[model samples]
Target: MPNHTLVNNIDHKDTKIITERSAAYGDDIWFTQTFPAEYRSVQAYYPIFFTKDENTGRFFSVALFGFQQNENLFIKDNRWSVPYIPLTHARTPFLIGEQALMEDGIEKHQRVLFLDEDHPRVNTEQGEPLFLEFGANAPYLESMADMMEVLHHGIEDHNAFIDMLVELELLESFTLDVELNDRSQHQMLGFYTINEDKLAALSSEVIAKLHQNGHLQPIYMTLASQSNVTRLIQLKNAQLGL
Candidate 1:
């Protein structure tokens, strides 16, 4: 496969960074971006993943870039915006489990690895998220579809998450799937309506835990009606005989 180009203008002579700072093993590169203010919930520690394409093969990389602002989750990096999901994490930490488990006769609750205990649970910090991404012998078009699905799951599984929150009492009975002005946005769907009063009373740590586990964006995009990378193939097919 003459490798469909995935990443372009990679300054590292086409070599990009993985899990943050791909400039070089010796180069201290810290990737950062600034996100919109409307999205207040994103944590700085959220890792961004990427992929590279060459004539012989394709590769993927995961990065945990830093944000200049202490208050937002967005990055200043031109190539690594929060929204782009790389094919590297086709199998993300966004695991779907049947139920909780026990370890050595004691309850073994598997916290989503994204959680950062050092941060004030809710104060304003998400600990350095563990970044792990790998490559495989696959093309971007197919690989990206699977990666996007995982991202979609992370965003749209709101109701299922709300159910989990109720089971955990992270919120005193929450509702979800609320849709917004745009059908693609939340207002059109349901909402995780917390008992407003009870919700306010909860601790920040408890709240942060919920945000970390929500996987909000991943699921939303996965199930979203608008995003369609497949359209590219269709357009190309039309020009095939040209």
Candidate 2:
């Protein structure tokens, strides 16, 4: 799984919607200041972590399903919120309210949730935490197989997923208008230029390998709305000069 690095400053915008993996537990909380009506996707199924602990052989997992946002500006109970707001959307366990925190001294940051140290159940033989995790959207701009490669393993070996291109026939291409986090935006950042020469050079040995492995396609798309995710991938692939 892709390892995560601390993003010290918010202005840098270094973080992308990524799939992270680790053997130890972690506490990473992200908050949103603006909630547009069209963007309820803030509550997408957050990718959880799976860590194996040899000390206790127990599988433990937790998911949040509710949200509570506090907008009361007058009292301590509502200090964490912006102020004078109504809780319009709270479908899942995503609580939008501001919670209390200890006063250390100088630097301060938001605290979302704290996980327990020990597992409740331990297997008779060994003590370990069996971890299992699932994420829907394949949040990468490259090819689908390439996307999985980077997510599961930090580096990708292109030779593995190359066969997917055989089944990936010619699909019409189009231009997209992308709006950046800043007011600036770009339209048609690039185009999907497929190499017919590469397709024609397929060898019999390569064909046999592809037949054995079977064809694969993307399971999930990652656009604001997934409707244009495939198209976006093609655009990115073209821009990359692949």
The CA lDDT of each predicted structure is 0.31, 0.26
Candidate 2 residue lDDT tens string, 1-242 = 22222212222123222112111211111212212221233223221111122476322111111111221111222122222211211111112222355677655545231112132221223222122123222222123323232223311222233225425542223354554334344454222322335544667786566556532211111122234334333333443454
Please give, for residues 46-118, the per-residue lDDT of candidate 1 as tens digits. Answer: 4322222246332222232221212122223322344542222322222222335887898765422121212
Alpha-carbon deviation at 185 in model 2, angstroms: 6.6
Off by over 4 Å in 2: 1-158, 163-174, 178-185, 191-211, 219-242
Q: For model 2, where is the 10-residue window of minimal lDDT?
A: 59-68
Off by over 4 Å in 1: 1-44, 47-73, 81-138, 155-158, 172-242
Give me the candidate number with maximum TM-score: 1
TM-score of structure candidate 2? 0.20
Q: Estimate each model's TM-score.
A: 0.21, 0.20
